[model samples]
Target: MEVLSHFVRVSISEYFRNLPVPDSFVGFARLTGTEWLTLLPFVGTVSLLIYVTIQAFKAKPVPEDTKVNRKIQKESSKVVNMVDIEDLGDKVSYCRCWRSKKFPLCDGSHTKHNEETGDNVGPLVLKRKGAA
Candidate 1:
């Protein structure tokens, strides 16, 4: 067992000593301008990846309800409008502010509401699939 271990150690040392060392493996201080330029993109890519990973980990997740309810007001009126999908156009902007003279449809009345209450309320636009 002692003879085998010594032989293995000697073989490993010989193999490592015979391996060729790359010229670029020299210290960073010895790197030439061209070598620095060649390494720039790799360094930049690695830095960008690290930055993005950190940002992703640090980011706070936003709630879906908050996104859906943004700038929407709660009204006492629980009126629901029934409209035929076929009757609607390819693109439709429905009233969300409930201030529309054309109830259930947008007539750009939210602009006045926004101006009066300093609220940024807008229409809920619906679009049909395959309708550019």
Candidate 2:
């Protein structure tokens, strides 16, 4: 039957022409029972999640200036005091008459050449005691 398939169409002028739209909250309540039920829980949950994310972005990071390990690493690098002979001359010059089989790099023969009582350690020995 043609009447069974036909839908009842309401005109926009007659159905909504007299409604107070902009000044009333009832205009926003145009949802069906099923649509309202489905979105009710999700609306509040999403609002709270957005609020938490905004708060996290506004937080400041903690400043740390007294980092001991970083300071020690920086200072220890300057204290090694090793030199290259290729730019100068024989490696024996750095150790000051101390012999090293490794040539350019000192093998700590200066530690044994001079008395241990003094602070006269070769470059290689100083590096072994934690160099940069």
Q: After superposition, how far is residue 121 of candidate 2 from its true place, in Å?
A: 42
Query: Against the hidden reference, what TM-scores do the models get?
Result: 0.40, 0.22
What TM-score does structure 1 among the candidates reach?
0.40
Error of 1 at 84 (Å): 1.6
Candidate 2 per-residue C-alpha lDDT over 1-132 given as tens digits, one digit per residue, 9 for 90 to 100 = 555434334443443443333346674587566655655555668799999999989867665733323322354544244555355432233333234455434666667645743545555322222324
The window of 10 residues in a row where model 1 has the poorest summed lDDT is 65-74
Global Cα lDDT for candidate 2? 0.49
| Candidate 1: regions farther than 4 A off | 1-77
Question: What's the C-alpha lDDT at position 55 in model 1?
Answer: 93
Model 1, position 78: C-alpha lDDT score: 47
lDDT of 2 at 84: 51
**lDDT tens digits, residues 42-126, model 1?**
6788799999999988969885644322333346334667899898989999998777778678999899878977889899999
Give the C-alpha miss distance for residue 99 in model 1, angstroms.
0.6
Q: Residue 6 in model 1: shift from native, Å? A: 86
